[model samples]
Target: MGCATGIVKYLVFIANLLFALAGLALVIIGILIKFNVSDATRVLPSDFGLAPILCIIIGAIVFITAFLGCCGAVRESTCMLTTYAIILLTIFIVQVAIGVYAFLQIKDQNSFYSALKTNMEKTFDQMDRNPEANETMHVIERVLKCCGVTGPEDYQTPKVPLSCCRNIEVQCPSPNNDVNSDGCAIKLQGEIEKNSKIIGGVAIGIAVIEVLGAIVALCLASSIRNSYRRHTYA
Candidate 1:
C-alpha cells in the first residue's frame, strides 16, 4: 500500500509537469499566431479573423490552469486538485463547443472557397507583376502544386504560372491546356481539416489525462487522510 501510494504520487507529479510544459508551448504558439495573424487580417477575409484571437485565449487559459494542476499534484492538496479538475473539464467542454459551432456555422464550403479563390487570384496577379512582393503566395502555389484557388482559369490572363507545371522545363499550363487543373482551394481545405482533426484528437487525449489526474489526486488525498486518521487513533 505504501509503495502503491508513492507510485501514484510520483506519476501524478510527472504527468502534471509534462502538462505544464505543454501548456507553455501552447501559450507561445498562441502569441505567435496573434502577432502573425494581426498583420494579415487586413488582406485576409473576415470569416477567419477571429481564429487567432481564440488561440491566444485558449492558450493563456491552458497555461494558467495547467500550472495550477501541477502545483496541486506536487503538494497533494485535495482542494486544489478538485479545482484543477473542474477547470480542465470546463476548458474541454468549451473546446468541443467551439469546434461544433464552427463546423455548423460554415456549412457552405463552396461560397467560402469562392471568396478565397478571388483573394488567391489577386495575389497571383500581384505575384506576376512583382514576384518578390508576393513570394509567399508563389511558394504556396509551387509547394501545393496548384495553379489557382479554383483552377487555372482563375488566372486573369488565362495563363498558368510556372509553379503549377509538372515539369518547369517542359511547358507551363496555358488556358487551352488543362494539365494542372487541380484547385488550391480544395487542397487548402483538406490540409485545414486534417490539422483540425489532429488538434481535436490531441485535445481529447489531454482531456482524458486531465480526468485521470483528477481521479488519482482524489484517491491519493483519501489515502493520505485515512493514514492520518489511523495514526491519530493509534
Candidate 2:
C-alpha cells in the first residue's frame, strides 16, 4: 500500500507538471491575442475589451495552482496538498459556473442577433467619427470577408469598401452590382459562438480533470498520514 501510494504521488506530480505547462502556453497565447486585439481597438475604451485579458488571468491562475499541486505531490506535504486540493476544487466550481452562464447567454439567438446588430451600427458610427476606428473596421472586413453589419447596402456610400471586394484587385466601383451581399454580423456571430463553444468545452473538460486531481491529492494525503502514524507507533 505504501509503494502504491508512492507511485500515485509520482503520477500526480507528473500530471500536474504537464497541466502547468499547458496553462503556461495558454497564458502566453492569450496575452498575444489580447495585445493584438488591444492594438486593433486602440481607439476604443479600455473597459470595452476584456475577453483576452480574462483568458490570460484564468490561464495564469491555472498554472500557478497546478504548479503548487506538483510541488505538494513531490514533497508529500499534507498542508501543501490540502491547499492544492482546495484551490483546484474552487477553480473547478468557478469553471462550471462560467460554462453554465455562457451556455445560457448563447442559447437565445434572436436576442443576441438584435444586440449584435445594434452594437455593429454603433461601431460603424464610431468608425465614422474616428479615423483609427475606420482603419480597424477595414482590417476586420478584410479578415472576416464581410462588408457591413447586414450587407454592403448598410453603408451610405457610392462604393463599397475595398476590403469587401471579392476579387481583391477590383475595388467595387459601385455597391449596386459589385459588392458581396453577406453581412459581417452573421459571420462574426457564427465565429463568436463557435469559439465560445470550443472554449467552454475545454474549460469543462479541464474542470473535470481538476476534480479528479483534487480527489487524488486528498487520498494521497490521507495515505501519507496513515503511513506516518504507523511508523510513529512502531
Q: Which candidate is the best by lDDT?
A: 2
- Report the lDDT tens digits of candidate 2 across residue range 5-89: 9899999999999988988987998888886666564422233366677778888998998899888988888888999999999
Estimate the TM-score of every prediction.
0.77, 0.88
Model 1 residue pairs with clashes? none
RMSD of 1: 3.6
lDDT of every model, 2 decimals: 0.68, 0.79
Worst 10 residues of 1 by lDDT: 36-45
Task: Provide the lDDT at 40 for model 1.
Answer: 37
User: Mind sharing the TM-score for model 1?
Assistant: 0.77
